[model samples]
Structure formats: structure tokens, C-alpha cells
Target: MDSLRTCVACRRRAARDELLRVVLSGHRLIPDDRAALPGRGAWVHPTPKCLKQAVSRGVFARALRASGRLDAGPLENRLETLMDN
Candidate 1:
């Protein structure tokens, strides 16, 4: 069976494969497309709406157990590019 995870932005539980995994690298957020990144990771729906809510509401830091704010620009750009393709 597939594992399940909760989306930090929408607060909905979904299958692991249905969501995108995000990890922290220094002070920036990185998208773990393969979910192979080291360190604490947070899951979120791979949607623009979820991404916006996660960033605006500062959910990634909380979910990842990261202190203070984290740079989400890289994640945002990644999502944008995915949407474009």
C-alpha cells in the first residue's frame, strides 16, 4: 500500500504519490521530486493554490520543524515551471 501524508497548506491527507515533497537546504526550500532529500521534509499538494497558501501562511517551516522563515522562491519557481510544462 502507498503511504499517506498530510498537506501542510490544505490540511488534507492524501497518498504520498499524490503530493509533492519539500525539503530544506540551508534557508531555502527545495522540491524533492524523488523524495530522496536528506533532512526533515514537508508534503503539500503540487498545486499553485496549495503552494501560495503554504508560503503565505508559513506552513513549511512549521511542518519541517524549521525555525524562523525559509526562502520559498526556489520552490515557487519550480512549481511555476512544472505548471508550464
Candidate 2:
């Protein structure tokens, strides 16, 4: 069976690889561009709108099972870079 995960921002279930992966690392939220990082993870559509929604809704923490605020700046930048490639 195909693996599935839900987008924390859009809250839609899709193929695991179809969504971008984010992982918690040292109290910071890092985007797993290659989805290879370990630890708790969160999923979201690779779009600013979804990222914004996820941030504004404060869902990353819960999804990643993290406490306090998370830094998604790097993730956003990485997304932009990936999109540009």
C-alpha cells in the first residue's frame, strides 16, 4: 500500500512524498528538503499559502510534536530555492 500523510496547513491527506517534510532539530523547525532528517516531522504543501497557513495557525509545533515557537525561515527559503531550481 502507498504511504500517506496529511498536510498540516491544508489538512489534506496525500501521498507521503507528495508533501514537503519538516523536522524538529534543536528546538528549531527545519525543512527536510530531501525528507531524510530524523525525529518528529510535519508535512505541508510546498507553497507559500500553505506555509503561511501553517504558521499563522500555529500547527507546526503540534504536528512536529515540538514545544514553543519554531523557526521556519530557513525552511521557507529552502522552499523558494527548491522551487527556483
Candidate 3:
């Protein structure tokens, strides 16, 4: 059976194939589109605006249960690159 995951920002539950997965590597947030990362993941709508909204509203931090501040630059950059491709 396929796994299902929910987007923290959009509050939408979707099949594993439908959402974008992101992970926090130390102080950086990186995209794990293949869903193979072994850590807490934050999901967004695979859109740049949604990514921005999640970061600005602190949803990503809350979802990951991260105590320290998060660096959104890497996340935003990865999202932008994905959007471009």
C-alpha cells in the first residue's frame, strides 16, 4: 500500500505522490521530493507562494517541533528551483 501524508501549511491530506516533502538538515531546510529522508518532514503545496506563507507564518517550525530558529533561505531557494524545473 502507498503511504499518505498531509500538508502542514494547507491542511490537506494527500497520497504520497501528491505532496512535496521537505526535511531539516541541521540549520537548513531541504527538499526531499523522493520522500526518502529519515527525519521529521514538513509539507507544502509545491508552490512558491505556499512555501513562503508557511515560512512566514511559522508553520514549518511548529510542524517540525524545532526549538531553534529555522533558516528559510535554503527552503525558498529549493522551492524556486523546483518551480523553475
The backbone clash count of each candidate, in order, is 0, 0, 0
- Badly placed stretches (over 4 Å) of model 2 are none
User: Could you tell me the C-alpha RMSD of candidate 3 in Å?
Assistant: 1.5
Estimate the lDDT of model 3: 0.80
36-83 in candidate 1: lDDT tens per residue? 988889999999999999999999988888998799989999999989
lDDT of each: 0.94, 0.85, 0.80
Best by TM-score: 1
List clashing residue pairs in candidate 3.
Answer: none
lDDT of 3 by residue, 1-85 (tens): 7777888777888787777888888877788878899999887778866787787788887888886778888778877787788
Give each model a TM-score.
0.95, 0.88, 0.85
Per-residue error (Å), model 1, residue 14: 0.9
Per-residue lDDT value at 42 in model 3: 80
Ranking by TM-score: 1, 2, 3
TM-score, cand. 2: 0.88
